[model samples]
Target chain A: MKAVLPDDLCKIFSKAGSSGSWHKYLKVGDWLVLLLSCALVVSSYTLLWRGGVADRAIVKRDGQTIIEISLNSARKTRVEGPLGTTVIEVQPGRARVFSDPGPRQYCVQQGWLTRAGAVAICAPNHITLELNGRGEASYDSLGY
Target chain B: MTPSGIELPITEDDRRIARYTAAAIALTVAEAALPSPLPGIKPGLANIIVLVVLLRYGWRDAAWVSLLRVVAGSLVIGQLFAPGFFLALAGAVSSLAALFLAVQLPRRWFGAVTISLLAAFAHIGGQLLLARLWLVPHDGVFYLAPLFATAALIFGTINGLIAARLIRQVETI
Candidate 1:
């Protein structure tokens, strides 16, 4: 059977032919970016590990800690926000915004907060939920 | 190539920018449809177009296409003027800046893969910074950096490979 080629493919193949190799493009900059990215990945993971696991989830509204829930229990709670209501669900070792009043539903889209220092914010509702590790606070007083 | 042989009055550079921007926007819109495991982590396939343009055209053209992709892609995805739009804009600007700097190095030593990695890291860094300052306003947000950086590495390599292949094909054409 004769092979059939798409018109665009045929045109492209006929116009010019592959010449240069990818190796020709490799320069010192490539190694630099690669090394830097690897370093960043390593450092970020180190920071994450040092931060430890979160045992509690803190729910805040308008910059005030409204409620703190333990990760050991599984529960769902609803909180009233400026726009409407936000439903927060706490599962084993994780918490998430099951529902939110924000137009974009960003908090809900955050899916879950499982790691220490992870957060989900519903800015329009002025509600923020954060995971807190059992260890000491990672940051000092704000406004440095 | 257009179906008709007749060439338009638009300059070759203008045509290249339009084509590349369209490709990037299409990728962005398609990516938006898929579900992401995390809020911020994405494959960033659209970056392939930026890398290709940078290699083929130049940094200025690549920057134009990258910026156009962010704005037009956001508008298409119904995210214009939203916090997400600003985050995307920040990422695009920083990524372009990183690519601009990376391109300055002796061309023989680096390829799309390296540029993609740099841009990816810069993109995530910029987004995280903006998120910390404007959105979350908490140090905790930085905790997600590891996951994001790992993702950037993986996706950057994939996008770079694809861009390299596409650039080769385009060169042949």
Candidate 2:
């Protein structure tokens, strides 16, 4: 007589074999992990690529960061530069050089910087203003 | 003591580790040849071998195979002791740590696929963290998180499926 497992017992063993393998290998926990991983990957987009709204704006006078303003509450800050006092306006989601005593009002005319990596330079006043955020930058490189 | 060669005692476990390590290293070198559109993204095919060793042998032996693969593969690619080596080392160590936690789950439910997916995420997470801390030192490094995480998901699922198949073959044999 040939030695072999009983038919019923062998059925249970053969059921878990590699052929038609996905159902066999993906168990309860594995399925749960797959679901969670998919969800995580989906959520990463909203969390990481929230790049439009910059969180902070930095005011630099002659290459020195003088004020780091949070772009949450609306406010106005004036910084004295080589030309004169340069006014920067901050809104809930953006910042701009409101006014500058520079010969050319380039920074003021640049309008609102609503995206991370956005920048405006009041070159005549030697004051530079830029936005930074925790999220991804919109442009590969920003500023004129 | 003369010119006679001295033989160091090698256990069965040592031999098994050596063999698995060699396999993993070969996969790593082969995978390196594939061009990545992004700087740090790869399918991480060698992870299938690492997961197999972890399941067949144990965590410690699997760890040995994984780490040796990083060092040996780096050497083969002429990246030994370079920044790339450190990145690879971080990925290996973190994925092993994740695997160490994975085996704690019930084997009946958590098999090679689940184990491989967890390790894949851990590997990319570790590399990104290292790059943020030491390499770029900026939040911009994390700008690539979604990309890497997506890579981890797609490649992780594929690698896990292949690993699950291999583990089944190993079991039946």
Candidate 3:
């Protein structure tokens, strides 16, 4: 095997401390502004974003618990069901079935799960997602 | 009764603001031609002029130029009294308020770039608040905050750099 040289590895970090033009433009206070913007972005993602949308989401397969997710972070979670893989996409306060291998694609067409008691059921795949929250909820299933 | 209209006096500041307003309006019209991937995101190139006037002239001149630009720009776009017009108004008012305080900071530490960043963030913040309250009427608007904030950081710094460069060029002349 050929020996890997140290000179090649050092090339990767050559641009690290060149003190690019940004250094010349940003002042002491400008750094504060940048940090403030970052804080605002993080706060928007974490706080009060779910006060009205939802609180949590439960993904189940055939009446068995798969996983429970909080509605506070954006993610694309894949769950293995009977038929195939089902992809669930989540925003800060809402969840949706992004894609699924189900034949009818009913759950995917339901779009975002915003309010409480909203459920997206991929029956063919045996995957069901139920949104539970404190917001205004609509009666979905009938037991009477 | 005499039908002749009474003459009102126009000061040099008025003329200067008129000129700056025209420049800002022209930038807004030109910006409208550019394609935007999102509804609230834009280059906001006119801010360079605002920062320039803020430093070159003073707060009063800059304030006049900014507020007039909003009203006049909307009029030209034919969106007078429309919801979009109010969004622009809120942005202008918030940015102007930010500048009013930013300009008072010690020049030794804070500079044009910082001021520009402050104004841009404030502008988007005001627009977002107003939009959530009146337009979308939902918390979904908060989901877009990060995207808008990132845009503010990028464009604010670029516009600040441009304004700094323009100030140097103009001063040397």
Best prediction by TM-score: 2
Q: Spell out the clash pairs found in candidate 3.
A: none
Chain A TM-score relative to the true structure, per candidate? 0.61, 0.63, 0.58
* Tens digit per residue, CA lDDT, model 2, A9-56: 234345554366466678888889999999999899887677656899
Task: Please name the candidate that would achieve the greatest lDDT relative to the true structure.
Answer: 2
Give per-residue CA lDDT, model 1, range B94-144, as digits (tens): 999999898886667777888888899899999999999999888777778
Lowest-sum lDDT 10-residue window in model 2 chain A: A1-10
- Those runs of model 1 whose alpha carbons end farther than 4 Å from true positions after fitting are A1-36, A53-144, B1-10
TM-score of each: 0.62, 0.70, 0.68
Worst 10 residues of 3 chain A by lDDT: A1-10
lDDT of 2 at B45: 83
Error of 1 at B139 (Å): 0.4
RMSD (Å) per prediction: 12.3, 8.0, 13.8
lDDT of 3 by residue, A1-144 (tens): 012211211232332343335466567877786777678767766664444456788899999988889989998899998788999888888899999999889999999998778899999999999888875553464231
Error of 3 at B34 (Å): 1.2
Model 2 reproduced share of reference interface contacts: 0.59
Q: Could you tell me the lDDT of residue B31 within candidate 2?
A: 89
Better structure of 2 and 3 per TM-score: 2
Model 2, span B1-173: residue lDDT tens? 57658788899788777777776777888989999998788998888878877887789998998998999989999999999999999999999999999988899777777888899899999999998899888777777899999999888888888778776665565
